[model samples]
Target: MPVTSVTTDTEALTLTVVADFPVPVERLWGAFADPRKLERFWGPPGYPATFDRYELRPGGIAHYWMTSPEGERFYGRWDFSEIEEPDRIVVLDSFADAEGEIDTSVPSGRMTLLFESTATGSRLTAVSESPTLEALEQVLAMGQAEGMREAFGQLDVVLAELREYALGKGTVTEVLDDTHVRITRAFEAPRHLLWRAHTEPELMRKWLLGPGGWEMTACENDFVVGGSYRNAWAPVGDTVGEPFGFDGENLVIDPERRIVTTERMTGAPFPANVNDLSFDEDGGITLLTLIISFPDVAQRDMVLATGMTTGMEASYQRLESEILASV
Candidate 1:
């Protein structure tokens, strides 16, 4: 079986897996709604699953154990907070002790699972939220995103075996400027809405920064050409920590049209890192184009080496959630 391809925001540690299966919406919902069916394909590939208790209702809890091929065992639990039947499942997932108690010391997050019926089939989206950006980074480093992707790939196979499954198809494409990678995704929301989420401090704090152990420190944006913007991120941990900061030079700010900014590492000040965001409306849906340009090929390589893709993906997911909530 081919491993399901996964994408992550290198900075935010967000993971997104998109796959289209041949199963109908109702059948797909059945697989997700029925605990018995869920256990059959919930764990990563090659990991056997056993459920201790499963109550799929609002405020219910699902506790299960997964044993790897090497005979290693681990426990995980999901506390369901909201269940919208065939549409959405909202829960808080975490590592748990044998007694099914959440391990508070470990990082965990709230996840919202969305199922949208499409012309071909159902479009399923799972978005997980962490308390802090560092928490997101930690989980990504632990291979959570890849593990989830593998598990979803397993689901694809299980669904296929049950019938003729049509695998979800998508591409991993990037927009670049000879050096840096800039990924772009357009949604049906207005440009002003998107801009508010990107610029407003209160709105930015929610999905822009990670968990508790971090602070924005400082953020200033002129929102005009020849103006400047600075965003500072600092670790909230006690011991020595690394601080990440970005300073930008605004080249364009066309409300409802586009905003272009050139960013650079605050203290280090590498060459220019440009981001151009444009918006267009099609019927009732809005299109957002994000173009990020780096100084040179070497700088682009350096940025990639930092693993920004997964973090950025997570940031985008958070942004999506905020956007949906606002609308």
Candidate 2:
């Protein structure tokens, strides 16, 4: 099952495979450098790979074997030529024998993967070249293009699992002072970018979507301390649920450093809560602390028992992949 388009051009002597992921480029690029990540998605669908030896650098080689559905093994090798971090990689792809030797009887492909940052997501273009047009055709006839498409589809699974905890979550939900429920997450983007994502309306609408088949219909924000903000969302199509709304008044605004706001839900049984977002910077990274405070212990416990943490983590994931990555 090809995830996207796999195009071949004999005139240009190249086979190009393209995929667009909502995640950041760094997340996609990590797959090539880490052997474990590489093994997760290098093979076509229904065939999982196991790495025999992996050395991802200039003049190094990656040797792996993909186990077929019927337990058969297909060995492959990548002889690296150039290694660029988070942007490009050049490898000589070939079939390998049982002992990891290149099978010279088959054609080899000089593949170049270029990762381009798009306005909404990241686009990956993989071009495989050959010494001659005949050699390129030889590999094309061997199903290289289709194999790549399937492999890219599997790559989607790997990225999804990784992005679920995009910041490598600390895994500890702190209950500070027994009133403020604080959830801290480290993001790969800058603090200013993270701030902009939360403060700006258009960017906020993309990631703050509540549940599936729901869309944010209105987002109004007044960043000043005495100002107010209102955001409304409704289910799309024939979704069977009532619309949700969040109306809050800004209590504190400290630019990228901190923000405190009160939230009142116009639907459901949840009580009003005050949210404080504090952003910290570490080089190009951002550490955000989100504290949601309720009126009393019963309210906090009720919210926690309702599995709010899981939903919060999921929303943070979208914020990182969709909003910050695009920025």
Candidate 3:
């Protein structure tokens, strides 16, 4: 759900990032206010960050080091300039060394995080400004964009678990019928935004990968009655194997209301699958009811036996952090 978008303005020497989250302004603010939580997703997926200093106001400094999978560590620090509660924060960011000294020889950027309250959730836009065009290019060349994207996806997972724990509600899953698999989950985001998350291919791709190390390389959705769609995904690392694929036909589409679709794993051993999804909105939350069907009870049980619910639940939980939450 760490779906982050970065736009570089060459003329202005800034890297602008915009993201959405389905939580209250204060909750989202906590991610930065708490050093422990910030380290959870501050670095890229394979690199876990450790913090030494934590500060939340002007003239304060925050320092951290990100350890790579191979045990190599990289340091970074931020000097806060301004802090507006549940609103915005501005800071000067720079690279650092093992001793926690800022690397002035390297590029430095001024970063700003802007927050806004929405009908269903909150929006955050981050701007990183480099002193020169060359410095901006240096940061981009260092894979900042891709790193931020991956880091945010991991952030999505963390936010969901944190919310559940804070609310004293463990993620609950229920089976409504034998042939019909029903899953109900509530989101802080509005119904319309949640509907777009289900319908839009770009948005859907972010949270569709149920677990880590899997990437949706291809997602093509026609988004209309009788239209066909295809999704392809596979192990992200050096796994030498062809990706798996799923192609389906849209049986019905009623924008923000309902959708029925038929799905089949390209080379799977089971029969095709059918699904009916309904969206209901009350107050500011959207309740998604998913009912899946199979050819028969045997096939339905077989699908369940394959441990589908666990992955589906993970995906839905991540969806809460991805959808309009990251818009």
Full-model lDDT for every candidate: 0.67, 0.76, 0.75
Q: Over the full model, what C-alpha lDDT does candidate 2 score relative to the true structure?
A: 0.76
Worst 10 residues of 1 by lDDT: 162-171
Model 2 regions more than 4 Å off = 1-3, 162-327
**lDDT for residue 108 in candidate 1, whole number 0-100:** 82
Best by lDDT: 2
Best candidate, TM-score-wise?
A: 3
* Candidate 1 to truth, TM: 0.47
The digit string of per-residue lDDT tens for model 1 on 229-305 reads 99888887683568888997877655665567888888895787777665544333444545566778888878777
Evaluated at residue 80, the lDDT of candidate 1 is 94
lDDT of 2 by residue, 226-298 (tens): 7988999899998887787888888767677667788888665666788866675544556676768788888
Q: Specify the poorest-scoring 10-residue window by lDDT in model 3.
A: 162-171
Candidate 3 lDDT by residue in tens digits, 122-216: 77788889999999899899998778766765555445543353222323445545666655566777778888888778787888886667888
Clashes of each: 24, 0, 5
lDDT of residue 83 for candidate 1: 89
